[model samples]
Target: MSAAPKGNGARAARTRGPVHVIGAGLLGASVGLGLRERGIDVTLEDLSPTTVALAADYGAGRVRTAADPAPAIVIVATPPDVAADAVERALTSFPSAVVTDVTSVKLAPLLELTRRGVDLTNYVGSHPMAGRERGGAIMARADLFVARPWVICRDEATPAEALTLVEGVALDLGGVLIEMTPEEHDRSVGLVSHLPQVVSSLLAARLVPATEQAIGLAGGGLRDTTRIAASDPELWMQILGANREPVVELLDAFGADIAAFADALRDPAQTGAKRRIADLLAAGNRGVGRIPGKHGSSERFTTITVLIDDTPGQLGLLLTELGELGINMEDLRLEHSPGAQIGFAEIAVLPEVAERAITDLVERGWRTL
Candidate 1:
């Protein structure tokens, strides 16, 4: 695991030889596609031959042959349940190659390898915080990791060269690098990623028993909150199981918060109950405000809602007019009522342009709300 070329110097990096990718799933295929885009040779493998072939046909990489030379690096992108085993096999099969896994939970696989008494000097655990609700190679995209945070977990025993090779791959794929210990990475993802998936799944599960009338009244808030709930349950089960301790602790704390809120609402006439409810809601607002805005900053913007008819090209015409007015929309969301003929477009723009955007839309024979 000698030092790989620095940055994305294409020629220097391309000389590093074939990068082997195991699993040929969404993350693995995406990694291959990205590396190939940088002129690096990539070889792909998966438990299912059909999956590997699909990824190769999609231009992720070529299938490995016996005549293929040894790879410089091997990325284990198998599902969480089999990640440790695949990593172990990769290390043994490609002794000189630096081995890394992109598993969601880091500590579990590391501990498993340690328990098996496997030599981990060539192994470095990493995770790219990017994915889609769907899985498999068909959904893979070359830019999946672009502008996303990729965590590298390194300990004192991790060789510098091994760490550098993994970091280079992350950087080559347009990922922002962050270094963390195994414990820290697990806990961080447990809170930010795993917890949210669990919460969203449970919230959406509640809808299964709801009446059609109740579900028909759903709005953007419900849709946005439950979007990730559509993710594969089998995959999430493995992730949640691997990071059980931290996720359980987080769920307990969240349950307590829910209980307190319920108590306050149930006793509105009690002393300070209204104040308690308000305080809880205010705390939520502050917590949301703490999330990084754009480019990891906390900048705020203003939102303006405009009404559009459900007829074809109406929304496109509105956007065309917006562009003609030189208004840059920071973010946009469209929500429609069931069986209604109209929809609302919630557009986020700089605070200075919000009033003007509303006025311009109104003057142009469009409705604003």
Candidate 2:
């Protein structure tokens, strides 16, 4: 339900009490930091007292003692298997607050909430569509959700006030709002999110018994392909199980593509069939175009790498120098090889800005490679 007409294309202001974040993991901690940065009083809670204290120490937000009163906006960010249960507890723990969950699997949790007779009026389902391979609150960032799509699953019984609060939360976190039915959210994620997990794991699994010489030949392409394999398996098992149906459908489609490629490899005289292989690769190129451009614009980018010494103020000094040079970076990645004292910082910039950045960094006594 839409709020009453108000400002110039802005979400309704937060009218609830302090936002309470549960789980104290990466997503939970990031949410707390983002909310507090927006001037919203945020409190973090976790099942383990020590983890909760650690999150508080990392500035996720003030940790709530067990005896403290419940907060108004309760965000459940636990694993998918326990998200519904956590949501139920949160709703019951704070009856007046608008409740939401940050679980990836939406339909299963929504159905569970409905079946368990949990109040639906003050609750809605949300997935921020962002995460990292690393875990824990120490890795949290306030800008983590910036420009990312935040999926909101709407239902008939979802209260207008609850939607307002959810939208406010996303907006304050710098996330773009996208509304979808729970079924739609599940299907879309299965194609984009779950399918990639399966593919990355399959690729990574092949390297288990490889020789040292073969592993030493690994390049950025293989690194890119298998990066997501480092994700926590326990969390993925719950996600895959929760969205099994949709993910299975996508895997079947992927299997067909793989089969076609296999047939192309075996055929020696089929010219037309070989062209099909080329077309398949071209299709991937086209698909990349469909993804949103950086910062919501149509701009594209290329990445450049700079080697920086691993020492205090090195990263900060590099960033400060880049600012002085007025070079805008699109994206950046830090990489360090085993037993190496220096780290490679991969920075993405607009193609037009690449040469200027390289020249500026070299002039500032920074290595381009």
Candidate 3:
């Protein structure tokens, strides 16, 4: 959280302004940037002077001064462990302002605040399911919340005006709001976000001791699976620790599946071993189908892989030709290997236009894979 001195041009146009962001890190700076661009007054605050300066210099917002008016909402973007402290401070500092937090785990902070006997009527816990592989003001994007799930954990005691103000900020930042209780939000994120980070990091950790040749053989699949392993471990440590109960339960179930699969693979000679393996793999397929986006149901769309030269403007040209052909690309994934002369662009399109998309690309002197 930070305090940047406010500017004069902010308007109460669509919604309210004077949004006090208390942590000028990734989420905090991003919220400031997003709201500032929309003509809303955003003040940046952080314990670190360099962080607040960096975030303000990046045009997130100006510094806050003692003369600044009370904000309509205070967004506490602190780490999970200290989020409750930040929220309590915000509530105390601005008794009339609606305070919210964007920390990953919602329940821990809510429980901590409740246990401390803090006033809860104005506090709304939230988690915006958006981030890059990295953190900091340097990586903050104004569009970070666009089309992402922003979970609002509002209790019955929360007033309508407070909820509206919080939801307004979410919608203004292009977030799709989803309402959940603190417990529901934590449990859901444990299954979807926290568990995946643990899995990805552990999976990537396995490659550390491997030989160079084995590492060289890695491709898109390995990269995709291990990508989040690059996330900030110190931050994740606090997050995973704060929401340990649900995450541990998920890990236990996941570990059991892994052990069962390994056991089945060890004894193909057993009567039902092969069947068990196939069933597990098929179950995996079904599970993947349920994931949103291009990875969703296979029957919903068709994917065409096109080869692209490792040169400037090659990908742009392919995309340009797709537009010229009037082919709507539903989703896209790019895969390139080190020192390779070509890259693969997997384009997802409607099933009806799949054959046409491939034929059109081939006719345009493009290679298809």
Candidate 4:
């Protein structure tokens, strides 16, 4: 979960208590809330007085005061642009604290801080690989970081206790700890996170002038590809700008793939064009297969779309029936039936068992689409 704790004293000290979260937005509030859930003392601060109050009101923690004791760790969850400033302030304000930040882009802020000659001793750059499409204290969830990777960037000079303190809090919040240099973290996220955001947003932008009929015909494929496009544009702009080097490199590579794919499809008559298209598409198939869980390669399983009423309890009843049938569903995806009071449950099962599942469902009065 995305909840929290802190550390003080020895560098290797396990998280002690009283985590001061700077920036009471989604990540900060979620950290406070998660820590508070574990009965850890947390203090909240933000540029917006109202935002901090809202977070505190939601039981994240009390609003910070000048009289409060120094925090063992300060989590700077501000936007990437101002992250260095916040981290610098935190390090100066709480000299004894092991300061960490959850900003997306890792290297820029680190460089900025180094440029300012801030002592690198107490500052540890970190980023939690977790977030929601929409962000705010209202969207904060205690379990946001559960099973997600929390990357800690430690230099050779980083003390064992400082690393332990940051890692301990990450563990307390159910994050899987990953150690990386700042450069590695930035490049990895550029490929996996930032590049995709740009692609999805551009793809969704194409639908803006489409006719209602054309748009209404969109299906799961479109939805899956464009879902992240709904993310906060302002936030993404800041992130993309901060990580421009890696993200731009990634976008260029990805754009080349798109151009190649489009050129092949434009005219099927060219020699080797069909094969090029197939190879590119097959590459996508192989890539998708590498992804974890429900969207595994179609070669691994056969999906049967069962039609059913969209009313409450109906989906649960289907799942209950599935268990009763002795059928094991490897994965499942759901889609709505537009303008109809029904939904489609696309259940993936081993090819060997798909026929029996569909037959059994049909026998139990379910329709398949």
Top of the candidates by TM-score = 2
Cα TM-score of candidate 1: 0.82
For model 1, residues 1-369, the per-residue Cα lDDT tens digits are 233432343444423658999999999999998888777899999999999999999989999989999999999999999999999999999999999999999999999999999999999999999899999999997778877899999999999888889999998888899999989999999988999999999999999999999998887689879999999999999999999999999999999989989999998999999998999999988988886653212134687888999765988999999999999887787878767899988888878998999999999998887
- In model 3, the runs with Cα more than 4 Å from the true position are 1-14, 295-336, 343-369
RMSD of each: 5.9, 5.9, 6.1, 6.5
Which residue runs does candidate 2 get wrong by more than 4 Å? 1-16, 66-70, 294-304, 307-343, 347-357, 365-369
Residue pairs in clash, model 4: 3-34, 4-34, 4-35, 6-16, 11-161, 12-161
Model 1, 46: alpha-carbon shift in Å? 0.6
Per model, how many backbone clashes are there? Answer: 0, 0, 17, 6
| Predicted candidate 4 versus true structure: per-residue lDDT over 194-306, tens digit per residue | 98899999999999999999998898799889989999999999999999999989989998988988988998898899999899889988987886654533545799999
Residue 312 miss distance in model 1 (angstroms):
6.5
lDDT of 3 by residue, 188-228 (tens): 99998999999999999999999998999997689889999
For model 1, the superposed segments whose C-alpha errors exceed 4 Å read: 1-15, 294-337, 342-369
TM-score of each: 0.82, 0.84, 0.83, 0.81
CA lDDT scores, all candidates in order: 0.89, 0.83, 0.88, 0.87
Model 3, residue 318: C-alpha shift (Å): 10
State in Å the error of residue 183, model 3.
1.0
Winner of 1 and 4 under lDDT = 1
lDDT value, residue 126 of candidate 2: 95
Candidate 1 vs candidate 2, lDDT winner: 1
